[model samples]
Target: MLRSAARSYSTKIRSAVRVPNESYIKDKKVTFDRSFPVQKRTKAWEKDGMDKGEWFKKNYAHVHARQKSERAINGDNDPFDKRSKHYERIKQEGSYKREQFRNHRSEYTRAHPLQGLKPNPLIDYVYGTNSVLSALLAKRREYFVKVSHYGPLNTQIQSLCNKNNIQVEETEKHRLNLLTNYGVHNNIVLECKPLQPPELSHLGVVNSEGSTYDKVEMDYDQSVNTRDKFMTKENKKFPLGIYLDEVVDPHNVGAIIRSAYFLGADFMILSHKNCSPLSPVVSKVSSGTMELLPIFTCAKPLQFFEKSKEEGGWTFVASHLSGSKSKTHLTLNELSGMLNELPVVLVVGNEGNGVRTNLLNRSDFTVEIPSGRNPEEARNTIDSLNVSVATALLINGFAN
Candidate 1:
């Protein structure tokens, strides 16, 4: 019976491979012209394809009628109207083609599993009918928002969500599986903010809450610990304050955060206006270190610095290239001698500019790195090290 089954399978495979003889016209000598056409001028067409008079008789009437219709509608052959129509047609065609391509690609990707391709995140927060975006802004101090309600570009967000374990919620009518658990009260709502800000505009109509009271719930107040409570946490060692001037590079920020976390720095603080905290780029670069680090942003960096200093901590600058015999120039042993008594707060500044003068003056000490023979050459080339590399050096130096 097994041998008979095998023979039957082989026969079926052979039959499936067979093609009908009528599919190819024997007289055409297996020509590709029917399958795929290539444009060319034939000898007959080259020799007087068709007489001008005959061509005019056949096609001129239709051409003239079209021109007359154009004149009747637009009063002249301006060409702009035709151009606009042409562009519109092209745009529609392009859109259709793109949509078809996307569908095919999506189907292909769904069929084939790739290890590197990230999975979609579960929805931690969902907005329907109510101003969920507005609520997010109001409670910005509480939660580390992973994705903003930018628009329907959730795919980009999905990659990040998968990496950091974030949740996504949508209020579209078709989607029956609404994330109503956790802080989400209900996805059903009627009267919500119809418009959203440029950054958070995606949540405007796609998913809105009908009842205002049900939609305004916030997770930050429940999730994060209060300042006093956070302070009282057991073994809260090395609560060093970090102040960023204009460090916009998220990768650098993430690396610095990783260094701080590993070197026993418990907390980090940033300038509220100048820096972005809990951004996806930073999260990805840090590789889950952001979750470990307690990040705080203050309105006034200088005031925060002073407060940290007054709390038995010493503020020091890491940039040693500045003129004058700055403590920034001190060796690890020398620096350790200075920091042994006081809780040290190390300040690494922006990529282009070093720390500001006012902050520099107030700092307890300024340290510098030793340079090459020609001080000018060293100073010029000294700008080459990445902020992350410099951070590693500074953190390891302090920990050692």
Candidate 2:
């Protein structure tokens, strides 16, 4: 019986084992195909019976000369080599630096905690006291993230979550803490859905020409304000919109949103390239003002503004180092005077490199807030203002 069992076991093991392919197991003999071979040009030196190594050295004499010109590198403590240790010491130091850099980078990945999204980063987590409550109250998103447990703000979010049919996990609080990087969760962290922007068909005003509104994914409460002529309002609040031309900073964008919303700006347009997305950080920094502001994104912001100028009669004014781009020394005061002429669109550019040349050319006017400095004074005194601060200033002027 034991002998029969052993035979069966051996047979089973053999069946389970995988054998390598015959081709893979065989020794590989690599050979180049001679069928497609091209004839090589024979040099005069080869015909003269020159050795290949000697021919190479003679033909590439300049390369050899460069090697001879370089200072000899010696191992440390080589007594016979009297040459200065400058280059060798430098090479050794450089090698040490390279090794140190490799180790530093290896440790960097371990210490920095990986910046981008994890496969599952809890979808999104909106934590502060106000952000948590506002996220729940806004109801702009489909449903707030369901939590197995609640922190200090549980009573507040419970009903809101239930009404929205948000799921409930009923897990412990420590998991929530880990999700937020131990932030002051206030006993609430929302793994909520993003606000789905209303479709373009449902947005924008129907122009007199009646068709040709290309759809773009935009965030803004259309029901709260409007889809069209949030541009033209009766309260003398002319359409005051802003285009962020590649403003990459989320903090800046968020602060600008808060400023724009509070200072009476209507909507915002974001360029597709070199710009930050409407992430959770933007929403958090805006203190929930992002929900209130109407944001439109366009692949070609320059073209969109141009079209608005020709068809929709919207005036796109690009804010720059100096509003000197326009032929007529156009000033902010001029924009105030021309307010009734057309809806205003202010284009704030990247922080370092103002607005792009093409965009500035498309503008109906240019605005440059003069540095409050003397003619000879260094720019350090006051070269430019923060984009958010600048936007606030412009919005305030438009609001008045």
Candidate 3:
């Protein structure tokens, strides 16, 4: 039995083992062969009076020459080689900068942030706040809309002064701070002015043809009062509107405004912390959409929504992906068709996390933009689209 088991084991081992493939062995050894082709020196090493390795090491002049020639072929320069002309050019740049700084001899430099930067030609223009206000003011005498989150309309007020070539009494104290915060140098030639007081009865008037209006001041003391100028009228306010729930990206906010304005949507309500539509980047990205819309700022978003409800506004929230029911995924065109024809408020939530539960609970309807494919292979690369892209999709959908 022991002899039979030994024979069986030997047979099993013979069956399991096989000769290695020649090609595999050859390929595997290619790296080692390339580095060291032969085991011993040939006639070339013997003539040099050195072993193969010694000959290769001692005659590195040829290797260096080959490297230099190959570098030239590949358009590469020796970084440490000062004799190279390219090295001198880089050195000159360094020396020139030092000299330039020495000549200036000051800690603060005159370099403007926008000095070398080019704004988008298609989107950006030389229109100052004063210029826009003046143009709008002069074009029609009937209406001029002024919306502000912080202070009163400085840009428009300044623009009006410039158009009329009159200096405003009010110097822009905080305006400079705002511009600096946005990294925009306060290099604009601005003319300041005080806002004309509103009339006792009428706050503003609307024009029929040009759709322009001017301010009508009410009875007030000499004090500069901001409370007299809330843009919303409790009675005449649009029944439905959207509130920005911490949508901080100004570009997204502006795009959303543009979308909302075009969709026959009434207004946008934003928290004080959220970016203003009048911000330079936002205005540029919105492509002048800021002119057509009105936005209101409130202390708290939920409180604002509650007040809106009290004033007869219905809130509709765009729900997030977590077990939230969106009627169906419809393209912009499809969403426009399904939207409520009556007065309504559309709420778009935060970018990463959707609407807060508290806000969602307050919403009359939780709408969502559908995604994924079929019911099985569903996934999204980004949990949601850019706020601006989503806003455009939302607004365009409800446009009809």
Candidate 3 structure quality by residue, lDDT tens digits, 1-400: 9999999898777555666789668756546568765877458888877788888878786877888888888877763365677778989999999999987786545454244445332222212453344334544223333322223546655555566554333335344334334333223322122212122221122232332322222244332212212222222232335667778777677678777765555556665565343454554455445544555554555664565455433435554555443554224444444333334556777776767788777766655556554445345345456776776666655554
Q: Give, for candidate 1, the lowest lDDT window spanning 10 residues.
A: 199-208
**Candidate 1 on 46-84: residue-level lDDT in tens?**
366786677666757887777778877876665346877
RMSD per model, one decimal? 21.8, 21.6, 29.1
Give stretches of model 2 more than 4 Å off. Answer: 1-118, 147-150, 167-178, 181-187, 196-226, 229-237, 323-329, 379-381
Cα lDDT of model 2 by residue, 288-394, tens digit: 78776767666656557655666556777778776355474455555564444446778899988979999877877787776656746665665788988888887
> What count of clashes does model 1 give?
22
Ranking by TM-score: 2, 3, 1
Over 4 Å off, model 1:
1-239, 311-313, 318-320, 326-329, 337-339, 371-384
Better of 1 and 3 by TM-score: 3
Clash number for each model: 22, 4, 19
- Candidate numbers, best lDDT first, in rank order: 2, 3, 1
Clashing pairs in 2: 148-169, 148-170, 148-171, 151-187
Model 3 sits at a Cα RMSD from the real structure of 29.1
Best by TM-score: 2
| lDDT of candidate 2 at residue 259, scale 0 to 100 | 93
